[model samples]
Target: MLKGKTALVTGSTSGIGLDMAEALAREGANIMLNGLGDATEIEATRAGLEKRTGVKVSFMGANLMKADACADLVAATQKEFGTLDILINNAGMQFVSPIEEFPVEKWDAIMALNLSAPFHTIRAALPAMKDAGWGRIINTGSAHSLVASPFKSAYVAAKHGLAGLTKTVALEAAEHGITCNTICPGYVSTELVDAQIADTAKARGMTEKEVIQKVILEAQPTREFVTVEQISGLAVFLCSDAAASMTGVILPIDGGWTAH
Candidate 1:
């Protein structure tokens, strides 16, 4: 479905971003994987995805916390593929702490990676997408984008801003045949979440299972973690011809957390 097209999925070395990249590749889109990972691992992943899917795969190692790096990533993608049809802003991080105790540096880091990085990438990729007269931009938002929780101030703020940005870009790009949307997911069993669960268990003197049940799964009706495949499938749908009319929308795969 996406033959001859190119996709850039940020923070795609692993987790949901990796799943999104693989899904797009399977649809015949050339893939550009971005993230901070070990050098050998990054190259191996690129080679493996290219070999398995029979789609060209490239890598852009950019520290997305810096705007210049974000711009360079777009430049590198355009250099490698000539044109970009899909942009998945999946690069983000979270810092949990009481608002009063949150470190200023951590707040800045979260905002830069989660919110500002997307802005830089969209700004750089929009002109090409507009020139091509077709594009899909998917921002990887969180369940926090719709609802609030304690101790995640920076993450919540960045995701809310990302949803707003997605809407604005969708409106502006509507006439140009480009659609922008946000995919808000519930807690997934990623390395990030694994670390958080471990920390929670240690902090509260609870087992990992107890922490997951009482804290992570409490807000979810399914009492289960959302899978990366589920989120990536939605991304694939959003990038399809069938979804051309869908823009400025925030689709939540949060297991009814947002519904209630």
Candidate 2:
């Protein structure tokens, strides 16, 4: 359905971002992947996606924490593909600490990457999308965007801000045939979440199993993690003509976590 279209997926070297990039590629969209990883592994991922999907694939290790770098990533995509029809703002960071003890630097970094980077990229991508009269902007928000948990002040704040940014973009871009929406996902068993589980276990004086069952999955009434395929599937749908009217929606793929 996306033949000849180009998608830029940030933080796509692995995990949910990579899966969404691949899903878009398989549906006939050229892909630009951005993230940090071993050079060799990243190259392999890039080459493998191109081979498997028969779509042009490129990789850029743009540091998303910088506003200039975020704009440059969009520019690079336009240069490589001549256009960027879909923008997936998926790069983010998480830090857990009480508000009083949270490092100021960490808060700044989280806010930069999680909130400011998307603003820069969206601003840079909008003009061309407006010119083309069609575009899709999908932000990877979290359940935190709607609800908050303790010890996640910076992360929750950034995600909540992202939700607002997405809605504003949707409203501003609606008339141009451009759509902006956020995908709010709950827990996913990725490497980052794995580290979070271990850290919570140690901090809360619980075993890993206990943390998984009691701390992480406790709010997720389904007692399951959201899958990468499911998240990417919704992204594909949002890009389809069927979802053309679905702008400014915070569609949650959490396992009934927010339903509480």
Candidate 3:
């Protein structure tokens, strides 16, 4: 459905970002992936996706905490694909600690990556999208965006800021045929979450199963992690013509975590 278009997905070397990239590529969109990973591994992923989807795939690693790097990443995508039709700001970091005890540096890093990076990328990419008269901007937010979680002050604040940013961008770009929205997901099962579960289990003197059931999935009403494929599928739909009017929406795929 997206043949001849191009998408730039940040933090796409693995996990949810990689899944989104693959989904767009499978729909025939050329992909430019950005993230941190083993150089060899990233190349293998890039090559494999390109081969399987029969669409152009490329990778560019950027430290998104830096404003210049975020801008440069967008520029690189435009230069590579000649036009960037889709921009997915899926890069983010988390630091969990009491607000009083949170490291200043950690808070800054989270805000930079989770909030400011999208601003920089969208600023760089919007003109081209405006000129072309079409664009889709998707920001991967968390349930924390609409609610709160203890020991996650920085992450929560950044995500809330991202939600506001998405709405502002949507309003500004509405006349240019550009749509901006945030996808807020609940706890997702990924390598990072698995590692967290193990650490939490050890720290709290609980079994892994207990950690998964009580500590991790406690607040999620469905008691299940949101799947990467499900989030990717929603993203694909948001980019489709049928969703042309769905802008500035903070759609949650959080298994009812935010419904409370």
Question: Who wins the lDDT comparison?
Answer: 2
Q: Over the full model, what C-alpha lDDT does candidate 2 score relative to the true structure?
A: 0.95
Error of 3 at 46 (Å): 0.4
Task: Summarize candidate 2's per-residue lDDT along 160-201 as a digit string, tens digits.
Answer: 999999999999999999999999999999987898888677
After superposition, candidate 3 runs with Cα above 4 Å error:
198-208
Error of 2 at 178 (Å): 0.6
Could you give candidate 3's per-residue lDDT for residues 1-260 as a string of tens digits? 99999999999999999999999999999999999989999999999999999999999999999989999999999998899999999998876556787799999888899999999999999999999999999999989889987667888899999999999999999999999999999989987678767755665688999989997789799999999999999999999999999999999999988888
Q: Candidate 3 clashing pairs?
A: none
Pairs that clash in candidate 1: none
Cα deviation at 104, candidate 1, in Å, is 0.8
Q: Estimate each model's TM-score.
A: 0.97, 0.99, 0.96
Q: Give the TM-score of candidate 3.
A: 0.96
Candidate 1: regions farther than 4 A off: 202-206
Count residue pairs with overlapping backbones in model 2. Answer: 0
> In angstroms, what RMSD does candidate 3 have relative to the true structure?
1.5
